[model samples]
Target chain A: MSLILAAESLAEIINSYAECDASSVAIAAVIHVALIGAFFGLPAGIFIWAERKVSARIQDRLGPTRVGGRFGWLQAVADGAKLVQKEDLCPKDADKPLFRIAPYVVVIASFAAFMFLPFTDGWSAVSLDVGMFLLFAMLSLEVIGVILAGYASGSKWALFGGMREAAQMVSYEIPMSICALIPIVMAGTLNLNEVIHYQSADWIGVIPPFLHWNVFHPVAGPAFIVYFVCATASCKRAPFDLAEAESELVAGFLTEYSGMRWSFFFLAEYASMFLVSAVAAILFLGGWDDGFGIVRALKGNSTNVLDPGVIAGNLLGAGVLMLKASKLVLIQIWVRWTLPRLRIDQVMTTCLKYLLPMSCALFLAAVVYPMALVLGTGRPQILPLSNDVSAEAEMSTSSEVEVERAAADGEVT
Target chain B: MTIDQYLFALFALLTCGGAISVVICQNVVRMAFSLIISLASISALFFLLSADFVGATQLMVYVGGTIVLLIFGVMLTSSSALLQIRTSPAEGFLAAGIGVLFLSVFSFTVWSVDWDRNEAKLAGVTAVDVPPQDYNEASSGNTVRPLAMSFVGLRPDKAGKAPGYLLPFEIVSVHLLVVLIGAAYLARTKRRVSAES
Candidate 1:
C-alpha cells in the first residue's frame, strides 16, 4: 500500500516541479505514460492467460492445466516466450513503415489518453476542465493510427481488417459518446470529477441504501445498462469485435505483426477495455464509494471531505473501481469465448440502428428525470457529493514522508 | 522581460511563420502538417496568456481534430506516386518573394504592438481580484465552468465583457452541423464508373 502511495506522491511532486516547461513537462508526461504502459503491458499478459483458460472452460477442456499450476498462471509467459522465439516475418508485398509502426501507434494513442484521466480527485497528471472530452478525443485518435496501419500494410487481409476497424470504432464511437453524454447531462458537468461525484450522490430513498444506489434510479438504471452495452462494443469485444474475426480475416489488422509488437495491441485492448469499464464505473457505479455504503460509514474524524488519507482513499477507490472494471473485462473475455463474432454489416447496423437510438432515449429520460425532481421538490433532490469518489481525494501533499519510509522498507526487502 | 513574454514571442513567431509556410506548401499532407505546427504554437501562445481552457480546446479541435481530418483526406486521395502536386518553379520563386515581403511587413507590425495586460486593473471581475483561496492556489481552479457560462447567456464571471455568445455560439453550432453534413457527403466513397468502357 505504501509502495502504491509513494508512486502517487512521487507523481504529484514530479508533476508540480516539471509542468512549467516543455522539456520537464514532457519528462513528467513520460513518467505518466510509462505507468500507463506498465499497467496495460502487465494486464495484457495476464489476460492472455485468462483467455486461454476461459476458452478452454467454454470448450469443456483443461487449458495448460499442467503448466505452472492448476490454473496455468504461467501459461501466457510461456506462450509469450514461444511467440518471441518464433520467426518474425513480413510478406514481400507488405508496406514496411506502416507494418513496423502500427502497434506503437496504437500503444502511443492509448497511453496519451491516460495523461488526462483522473485516478482520484486531483490525481491526474493533466486535468483539463474538458478532461472527459479530451480523453475521448485522444481515444478517438487511436482509430486513425489503426486505419493507417491497415491501409499502409499492403495486404488484402490487413486492408480488410483496417477497414473493419475504421468502420467499427468510428460507428460505435457515436453510440458510445451519446451514452457517455447521458451521464454528462445527468451530472451537469463534463468535468470528470464532478460527473463521477454526481453519479456517486446517494438518493433520498429510505430503506436499503444499497438498493437506493445507482440500480434504483429509473434514468440512471437504463443509462447504466446502455453504457455497459456501448462500452462492450467500444472495447471491440465478442459480438462487436468484427475487426478481428480471426477465422475469417486471420488475426485482422494484426496479421503482419509478431513478437513484442503484436502483444502491444492486446495490451492496449485489455487496458482500454478496463479503462472504459472504469469510466462507466466512475460515471454510473459509485466509483470507490462501495455503493454498499460501508467505506463512507467507516471514515473517522473527517467532514473535511478531503484529507491526507484521501489519496489512499482514492487509491483504494481506484482499486475497487479497477476490480469492478476487471470483472466487466473478464465478462468480455467470457463472452468472446462463448459467443461467435457478428458479421461486419451486422455490427454496423447494430450500432447505428439499435444501440445509438436506445442510448439517445436513455439520455433524454435521464435529463428530464433530474429536471422533474427540481419541479416536484421545489429544490433539486439529486444526491450531493456522495457519488463523487474523488471528492474523497484528500490533497494532503503530506504523503512524501511515507515515501522515504517505504523506500527503507523496500531496501530491507 | 518575463519568461511568459519570451515564450509568447517565440510561439507567436512560430505560429505566424508556420502558417505562412502552410499557405505556400503545394503538397496537401505537408500543408496539413504545417497547419498543425501553427495551431500548436498558437495553442502554446494561448497557454502563455493564461487562457488554459481555450488553449486545450485549440489542441483538441485544431491540432488533433481539424488537422487529423485534413491529413486523413489527403491520405485517402493521394496515391504514393504523387506525394506532391508540383507548381512551376517560376511561380514558386514569385510566391516566395511575395511571401517574404509580406512576412517583413508582418514582422514590422509585430515589433510595434504594445499589447497591454490591464495594468490599471479593471474592476468588477471579483473572482480575479479575490486573494488566492486555498483551493484556487491548488489549481488554476477548473476553467470548464467559466468557459461554458461565457458560451451561454450569462455574465456571472466576466460581467464587463460582452455577455455570453448566445447568438455566435448558436451560429457556430449550426455552422458546425452544416460542415459536418457537407464533409460526410463530400467525403463519402462513391462508386467509380469504368472510364475505359
Candidate 2:
C-alpha cells in the first residue's frame, strides 16, 4: 500500500469504529513508524552481508561459510549478535556524555533521511513537497556525529579522523549538491515523485521506457557520473575514505568506539550508502518504474487502495527500485575493493579542481539544453514524449501573461 | 492538544533548553554542540509552522554548514590550555544583566504589537487583491517556486505590482563573494609569511 494513503485509511477506520480522533491518529503513527523502522534496518543488514560477500569474492576467499548455510546469508545477523554481545568501552580521557551520544546522532540522521525517500509511488513516510532538499539536509547532519566521535575520543587518531571528515564532507558537499541540482533543473521541480513522473513516458514511442531516464540526457549523463563519484566520497568509502583510513589513522573517528556503539556508525554508513544510491536511481534512473512499463500497466488507472493489481504493481515497483539500488551498491563495493584509496590532498583536489568545475559546467549545460532545443525545433522538448512539453509551455505562458497584465496596468495608470 | 501543538511545545522547550545549555557549558565544544541543538530545534519550529523550505535551508546552512565550520575552527586552533575557558562570576553577572535587559526590550516590542489586527489586515489585503491560487500556494508550504520567482523579480503572489527581491538578492550574492575573496587573501598572506619565516 502507499504508506500515506494507508495511514489515512487506517486512521479513518479507527475513527469510524471507535470515534476518537487523537487515539486513531496516534495508533496510525505508531504502526507506520514501526513499519518504516523495520524497512530502514533490513536494507542495512542485507547490504552489510552483500558487502562482506562481494569483498570476499573479489579477494578470492570464502566468506562466512559456517553460518546460515553454505552461502552464509545470515552472516550479517551473526555479526550483529556478536557485536551486541561485546562490552561497550569508553576511554578514561574521553568526554563520556558526548562520546555516548555521537553514534545515536549519526544513526538517527541517516534513518530520518529514509523518511523522505519514496520506495514506490506515494509510499514515503512523509510526503513533503521539498523532499529532496530535506533529504540532503538530513544526510548532511551525519558529519556532526562523526566529528563529535572524533573530538570526544580525546585520542590523537580520533581527533585527526574527525578533522579529516569535517574538511572532506564540507568540501565535497558543494559539487554533490550542484550535481544533484542538474536533474532538478531539467525536471523543474524539487519533488522526487514529480521527477519520476517526468521520466515515466517512453522516448520516441518505439524506444524503451528506461531510455526516458535523465541519465540518457547529454548533460545529465556526465552529471550522473560526477554525482556518483562525489556520492562515494561523501559516504567516506574507499578512494575518499581518508577520514577513517585504517592504515594511517587507526580506524579514524572509530578508533575509540567498540561494540554496538561502533556498530551504530557502520549501520549509519551502510544505510546512507544505500540512501544515496537510491536517490541516484530515482533521479538519473527511473525510480520505481520498471523499464518495461509492466508495473504501470498493472497499476492501470486503479485508484482503489485494496485492489490486488495495484498492490502487486506497488510491490513489483518497490522490488525494481531495490534491485536498481542494490546493483548500484554492488558497484560501490566493487569500486571500494578494486581501487586504491586516494591521499587526503588528492581527494580534496579531485573534488575541488575536477568535479566542482565539471558539475558547474554540467549545470550550465543543463540550463541551456532545453532553451537550445526550443530555439531549434520550435518546441521546448525534442523527444516525442507526453505532456511535459505542454506543461513547460503552459508555465512559460502563464508567466508571460502575468508580465503582460502588469505592463498593461502600468500603461493604464 | 492536537499533535501540532504538542510538537510545537516539545520543540520550543528543546530550543530554550539548548540555548540555556550553551550559556552554561564550560567546554567550548559542548557550547557549540548546544548551539547546534538550539538552531536545529528552531528549524523544527519552522517545520511545525509549515515553512518547509525555510526549515530545510536553516538545517542545511546553519546546522550543517556554519556550525560544522565553527566547530572545525575550534578544534583546529585550540590548544589543551585553551580547551576550557572559565568565565569569571563578575563577567557572568554582567552578561546575565545584559541578557535580561535585551529580553525585556524584546518582550516589550512583542507585547506592543497588535498581532491579530495585523493578521486580519494581511488577510484582508490578500483576500481581496490576490488570486486564490497564489494565496493557496503561499499558505500550502509549497513555497519553493513562488520564492524562486520572487527572488528573480517576479512576484506571482502580488499580481506583479510590487517589485521582487532581485536587487537585494544580487547585492547579498556580491557581498558574499567579497567576503570569500577577503578570506582567501588573508589565508594566502598568512601562508606566505609562514613560508618565508
Candidate 3:
C-alpha cells in the first residue's frame, strides 16, 4: 500500500515539476504501466519457483535444490535463461502471423485483469467502479488467444484441445460469475475496495469484525465453495485441466509452442492462478485485514504524515493480503497434485449440472437472507455504516485517533 | 495531442485496421480472429468514450461469446486445408464499391450533425462551461446501475420525455430464449448406422 502511495506521490511530483498538461498525464500513465509490469513480472517468476517447490513437497521429493544453493530459489531464473536460448519453432502448415501473435494476446489479457484488483485499501493500478466486471471481461479475452494458438498450430490435437478449452471455459464462466455476485450482493458495491471496507464492520452488530467476512454468512459460505471450484476451473487448473490433458492430447494446445512462446502461456497461467486467489481473498475472506484486528489497531493509531508507523502498517497490510492470497494459491497447487484430472465430459457436467444450479440457489438464498432478517428480526444481516466506506477511509487518513475513537464508541454502543 | 486523443487515435487505428483485415482475409478462421480484434478495439473505443460498462459488455458478449461461436462454426463445417474460401472478383469489386458508398454516406451524416450544440442545450450551458466530468472520469461510478434501472422501466437520468427500456429488455430476453432453443435443436447430433456396418 505504501508502494502505491509512493508511486502516486512520485507521479504528483513529476506533474508539479513538468507544469505541462498532457505530458504530465502521459508520464504518469507510463509510470503506472511500468509499475504494473514490474508487479506482474516479479510475481510470475516467484510463483513458478513456488509451484515447483510446493508440488515437489506434495509428491514427497526434493525440488530444484542445485541452482541457487540452499533452497534453489533461483530455479525459475535459470529456467528462464535456458528457455530464451532455445529456438522458436513454427510448423510448416501453421498460420505464421496468428501463431506468432497468440502468446502476446494471452499475456496481455492476463496482465490487464490485474489492473482492477486492489492489493490493499485504496491500492490498485486502476480502481474502476466496474472493477470485477472489467476483470472478468479481460479474463474472457484469454480464451481467444488459446483458441488462436490451437487453430494456428494446424495440428489435429491442438484443434481438439482448443475446442475443448473454449467449451469448458465458456460454460464455467456462468457459475463463476454467479458465485462472485453473491459477495457483491452482500457488500452492496461492485468496487472491490469498498467490499473490503464493508467487511471491516461487525456482523449484524453482534459478532466479531473478523467474522463479518461474507464467507461466514450462511449464503455466502456455500457461495465461497462454489466460487473456489469455479475459479479453479476458470484458471484451467486440475482436476479441470481438460484443455491440456498431457496424456491424451500431447500437451493439447501447447504441442506446437516452444521456447519463450510456450513459457508465455505458463506465465499467464500462473499469474491468473495468483490473480483468482487474490480475488477470492478479497471477496470471500477479509482483504488485507488481519482477522485478529492487530493491523487495524496499528492503522487506527498511525498518523498519515508518512511516518515510520504509518508506512510499517501499510506494508504490514499488504504483506497480510499477499500472504492470504498465497495460501490460497498453495492450496490450489496442493489440489492439483492430489486430485486426478477429470475427463472433458465430466468437467462440463460438473460445471453446468452441479455448480451452475448450486450457485443460483446460493444467490437466491443470499438475496433472501437479508429480507428474512429485516422481516423477522427487524435488522439487516450486515449493519449499515452511518458513514459511507469511502468517508470513513478519508477520516482514517486525516486523523487516525478520531477515527479510532469513533470506532471504539460505535463498537461499545 | 493529449493522452485521450492519442489513445483514441491508437484504438481507431486498431479498429479500422482489424475491420479491413476481416474483410480482405480469405481464411474463415483468420477473418474470425480479425473480427475479434475489431470487436476488442471497439470495446476500447467505448472505454475512451467513457462508457466502461458498455465496453466490458461488448468485450464479454461479442469478443468472447460470439466470436468463439463463429470460430466453432467455421471449424466444424470446414476442413483445415479448405478453411480459406476465395471470393469471386466480381463480388469483391461489388462489395468494395458498396462499402465505399456506405462509408461516404455515414461520414456525411455524422459531419452534418450539430452534436456539440445539442449537448450544450441538454446541459443548459455554453460549450466552454461544460464541466469535464464525463470527459475525465473514465471509471468513477458504477455505470451498470443506471443502465439496469433503465432496463427495469426507470429513466432517472433523463427527466423529460424519456423512454423506459422495460419492453425492449423483455423482448430481447424472450428473443434470446427462442435462439437458445433453436440453436440446441439445430446442433443436436444424429445417431449413425453403426449396426449396418
Candidate 4:
C-alpha cells in the first residue's frame, strides 16, 4: 500500500527533475534511506530515555537530572557521546571479526524490520504484502547476531547468555506467531493495513467502533494478552529476560560487550519492542484509526486534495498509532521494573507449555467463532454492522415521515 | 542502470559474497553468521522475484528458525577457543573447484531454458512491448489469500490446473508435531542417578 503511494510520490517528484531517470532514482533512494535512518535512530534514543525516566518514576527517583537541562532530556545523547569516546576493547581470546560485526548485524535486522511497519495508511517505507511475515523474519535474524556476539566474546557468561536467548527467542516465536494469527484469521488478510481496516467494522449492527477492535472480541481478547506476553519475552524484557539477567549471567549475551557495541544490543532490543507493539496495535487495536471516524471525516470525500485536514488527519493518525505503541512500550517498561526475571527453564515452560497451547486454542476458537456465528445467525459476518446501523436509521427516518403524513391528513380531515 | 537492476545487482552481490564468506570463514560461529547473510540475501532475491510470501517464509523458517537452532547446537557442543575448525588449503581448493563446477552446470541448465518466451506467452504478448494490463498479469497477485485458500483445499489461482495444499499442509503440521515431541523427548534430562544409589 505504502509502496504504491511512495512510487506515486517518487514519480511526481521525479517529473520535475527528469523522468524516472538515474538521478531521480538516486534522490528517491537517498531520501528513503534517510527516512529509515531517522525512524530507527530516533526511536532508539527516545525509548532509552523513556525507559530510564519510567523506571526512575516507578522507583520514586529522578533518572537523569544533569545532562541537558531540567528533566535531562538529552541524557541519551550524553550517554551516546560517552559511549563513542569509550575505548573499543577486545578480549585477547575473542573472535575479533565476528565480535566487531555482530552489533551491526543486529542493528541492520532491526532497521530492516522497521521498514515493513505502516505508521499510517499508505505510509510504510516498503509496504510489501507479507509485511508481518517479513517483520518476523527480519526480527528472527536478530537472534543470530546475539548468538554471534556471545560466541565471539570467548566468555562462558556470554556463551550462556547467547544460548539462553536463542532457546527463549525460538520458543517464544511459535506462540507469538500463533497468537498474531487470531486477528489475522478474523481480518481474513495478512496485510497489516487490511487487518486494522477489518477491526474498524462494527459488530451485530449495534457495537461501537471501539468495541469492534480485535482485543475486545471473545477469542482475540485472550490472544492479545498472549501476544503481548510472547512479545515481551521475545523482546527480552524483564521476567523472560534470562538472556541478560544481571544477577545471574552478568548481562547475558551482552556480558562482554562495552560502549557503543553494548548500546547497539539495547538499540536492537528497544527497536524490536516498538516493532512488536506497533504490530499488536495494527493487528488488534484500531491501528491508525482513532475509532470514532474522526480521521475519515478529516480526510473528507475528496480524492485529489492534499489539504490541511487530510494531512493533519494522517499526522494525527500516525501520532495515535505511535502513542498506542508507546503506551504498550511503557507497560513493558513498567512490567520490567515490577516483575522478577524468570529462570531459563521457567521461561521455556511459560512459552511452550502454557502460551503455545493457549495461542493454538485461541486460533482454533477464533476460527470456529465466525463460523458458529454464521451457523447461529445465518449472517456471513458480524461486521458491516455499521451498514446495518445506517439501514436501521434510514428505516426509522422513513417511519417518522409516514407518521408526519398521517398527522397532516388527520388535521385536514 | 534502472533502480531495479541496481537492487538486483546489490542483492546478488550480497548473496554470493555471503555464500563465499561462509565457506571461507573458519570459526563455526562466523560461518553461521555468514550463512545467515546468505539466507537473508536469498530472501531479498525472492522478494525481487516478487514471491513476497516465499521470501518471508524463507526468512522466517530458514534464516530465523533453523539458523538459530543450528547456532544453538554449535554453542552447546563446542568450546569457544576451539570453535575455529580450520581446513588445509589443498582441501579448500578442491572444494572450491567442485563448487565452481556445480555452479557452472547449474547456470548452464538455467540459461538453457527460454524464460523470456515463457513469460511473454504468459503475458499474451509478442515483441517486447507489454501493455500495462499485460505487465500486471506478468507479476503475480497478492499470494497471501491464494496461499491461505490453497491450504484450505481451494486453488483459485489456476483453478483446476493446480492441486490444493490442504492435505499436504495437514501432513506437514502433523509431522511437525511429531518432531516437536521427539525433540522434547531427546532434550529432556535423564533422571540423575540417585546420589544414594
Each model's TM-score, in the order given?
Answer: 0.78, 0.93, 0.88, 0.87
Clashes of 2: 0
Tens digit of per-residue lDDT, candidate 1, span A1-413: 11012134444566586664444434554676677666666767777788888889889998878768678898878877877786767767665655676677677767766665556645665555566776776677677567656765667787778778876877777778777787676556676765655444343344334443454667777777777777788777887887788889987787777777777777777777767877777677755666654445444336444565554566666677667767877888887777777888888888889988898887787777767887987544444434434333421212432343354345445
Please report the candidate that would top lDDT against the real structure: 2
Compose the digit string of candidate 2's lDDT tens values, residues B101-126: 99999999999999999999887765
Ranking by DockQ: 2, 3, 4, 1
Would you list the C-alpha lDDT of every candidate in the order shown? 0.66, 0.84, 0.79, 0.78
Listed in order, the DockQ scores are 0.19, 0.39, 0.31, 0.29
Query: What tens-digit string does per-residue lDDT give for candidate 2 at A10-92?
Result: 68867888987667877987887788788778988999998888889999997767789788999999999999999999999
Q: Candidates sorted by TM-score, descending order? A: 2, 3, 4, 1
**What is the alpha-carbon lDDT for the whole of candidate 1?**
0.66
Off by over 4 Å in 1: A1-34, A82-99, A120-122, A201-215, A301-312, A376-413, B1-52, B59-68, B75-84, B88-93, B117-141, B180-197
Q: RMSD to native for every prediction?
A: 9.9, 3.2, 6.7, 9.1
CA lDDT, candidate 4, residue A81:
93
- Check candidate 1 and list the clashing pairs: A197-A387, A197-A388, A200-A387, A201-A387, A307-A394, A310-A394
Model 4, A1-413: lDDT tens per residue?
12232344555677686765656756775677788788788877888998899899999998998888788899889888999888888888788998899899899988888877888866776665677777888888888888888888988899888888877888898899999888876665566776776665433445557777888888888899999999999998998889888888898878888888988888888888888999989988889878777776677655654778778878888998989998998899999999987888888888879999998888998888878988999864555554543335435645754554454345445
- Candidate 1 chain A: worst 10 consecutive residues by lDDT? A1-10
Q: Worst lDDT window (10 residues) for model 2 chain A?
A: A1-10
Candidate 4 Cα misplacement greater than 4 A, ranges: A1-8, A201-207, A380-384, A388-413, B80-82, B86-90, B107-141, B183-197
